[model samples]
Target: MHIRRRRAVGRHDASDYGLRGAEDGAGADHPDLADRRHQADHPPGVAQVAPWLKAYFTPAEHHSPEMKEALRLSDELVAKLIANDHVVIATPIYNYHLPAVLRAWIDHIVRKGLTLGFDGKGLLHGKTSTVLMASGGIYTDGSPIRDRDIATQYLRLILKVMGINDVTIIAAGGAKGVDLSRVTREAFLERLDSEIELAGA
Candidate 1:
């Protein structure tokens, strides 16, 4: 099983961490599971989906040279999503939602003819997904601010639309403590070690 690890921020490559097969419970030691990382880099003007949409809607015969160029990255991203059995989206929440780059990545992958059908059916099936989200505040069950967990809900809905029903979300809430130096990063992560291991397995 091949898994695509998408890090919303390009600062780090997820492949370096060997976090493959987390969705299917195939532990990292699974011999057949391989990790393929795709960093969603924040290149200048790369997150604009309008140009790609314009090119995609234009008739192929009447497409300009620039149209093809506009579709290049979107096509590549969609193709990669289709090729993988499992997809891991590691992102940080921004203002109670997804970062611009991650949202752009979703826009690029949710293609009409490829990932989504014209009839509103999802083309990509039999796939699983894992969402690793770090948030500044706690919003899990029992939290008063749980209703503010828009990012998780949005991702689940989108993935379901793309025919990926089996999804696991590992929420690392209260991450601000790390930034504030109230809790060590290692200690915070250690608290979630079992959850992370189970998700990976």
Candidate 2:
């Protein structure tokens, strides 16, 4: 099986938290580590499928050139997702939530004709997904700000709307300080490691 890696940030994001594109960098130190580590340990069992990465994140709007392009991009992304057996989203949290770029990207791909039907029934099925989120602050189940995590929650709910019920979320945060950074990164890796094993099983 192949694991698709979905990155939600861009180059300019580097200035902030050094950008999570770097697996070991400060910004989301373990960004997408789940997919990367899983693919490494699992050999060819997993591969990152992302044709829409080139589409990147586009501006949010329903009736504009960007939206039109987003629709096309989303259509392709949906196709890829439909074709894949497994998928994983590697993302970093921004302001107690996922970056706006990811939201915009989702807006394009979760199309009615593609992932859902006119009767509001989900058409996309027969696939499982996991979400790995790296954040600057802790937001676990009992965290004081758990309710503020719009990104992860939205991801779970939205993916459900697409008929993907076997969804799992691995949220790793509390990287705000030098002390918390290493600890947080380790925890993130550990969680991903466990999840990878489970997926392999």
Candidate 3:
């Protein structure tokens, strides 16, 4: 199966952490994953979503020249989703939720008659997804702030809406230690290696 990885981080950071681990575990050299055609190296531009929303709500505008141009990137993003069998989303939590760029990418992909159906059904079926999230605080079981794990919760709901019900979430919590110099990035990532490998497998 072809795997497409969408990451909401800079190229350097994306390669430095969980995304790279997942890629390696999934066999980066494998033919299906080797072709980077469907991978989104960086998050989409957040500013462009405004025009996309306008065109999305106005069905008549979909065929218009201006609207077509506005929706080009969104279409491409959705096309990638449709093409891949497995989707891996690597993102860092921002304020207990998705980063602005990742949210914009989500907005562009949840298109009616494309990824979603006109009858309130999802068009993207038989696809699976994995979300690799790095957060500053622990939000898993036993964590007092578990309810604030909105990023993971939101992603699960949205993926289900898009017809990807079989989803795996790898939560790499307490990542702020790397930023604070309390732990090296490599060491922090090592702790979640098994989880990342399992998800990729």
Candidate 4:
């Protein structure tokens, strides 16, 4: 009914996306941590399933395999998106934008004729999504870099263009500087744990 704003963006490493493994494997057996349990819980009698897929970039020259695979993946990815009730995007922000690999993936799945309009309007409204990210510097409430974080804002805009607006974001910032990494990492991890706990609700 009203406008919604997003949280700050952070710098990230290529390895941070391993969180998706946890998302995909959420229903699997794991230790009894509250968050883990929360993650694994599902509606009564409803089965849980995790289907994994990958996308890669093809240069302007269109490397044969990469381009072919990306095109194919795009169709499947967009279809999966259309069918999904919830979507989770686990990524690291790169130089204030999306990671190159993730960006390419977005480009592939967000097709003009299929997922969204050519004028950047979205068709998939009413779906919900969550994004988990880590940054090299603190861009959250405690820091001064809040205004500089643009990655989440960009992502939210893109999703809106595709008509997906019910979104949530978890950003772990301040993981870069030598003197602040530990504090920032702790803060972000704590939030991550909290999110997992809330997953069951």
Count the clashes in each prediction: 1, 3, 0, 9
lDDT per residue for candidate 1 within 1-201, as digits (tens), equals: 223243211111222122222343543444433233334343223445577668888877788889988988777767767877777776678789987666766777787888888898888788877777778899999999999999999999998888889988888788888778898867866776776667556
Per-residue lDDT tens digits for candidate 3, residues 68-183, read 88888777778767877777666778788876666767777888888889988888888877677888899999999999988888999898888989988878888888878888
Q: Model 3 shows how many backbone clashes? A: 0
List clashing residue pairs in candidate 1.
25-201
Query: Highest TM-score: which candidate?
Result: 3
Cα lDDT for residue 182, model 4? Answer: 45
Question: Which tens-of-lDDT digit does each residue in 35-100 have in candidate 4?
Answer: 211313211210111111222322335446645543554556567677665555656666767765
> How high is the CA lDDT of each candidate model?
0.67, 0.54, 0.68, 0.52
Q: How far out, in Å, is residue 92 in model 1?
A: 0.8
Q: Report lDDT (Cα) of residue 168, candidate 3.
A: 81
lDDT of 4: 0.52
Residue 42 lDDT (model 2) = 20
What TM-score do all the candidates reach, one by one? 0.77, 0.61, 0.78, 0.61
Point out the higher-scoring one by lDDT: 1 or 4: 1
Provide the clash count, candidate 4. 9
* Predicted candidate 2 versus true structure: per-residue lDDT over 1-201, tens digit per residue: 113234321111222332243344433542432232222222110013232332333323424554455346455556656666455666777776666555654655566656777578777677677666767777788888878888777888877887778877765565454244554534545545665456435
Report the alpha-carbon TM-score of model 1 versus the true structure.
0.77
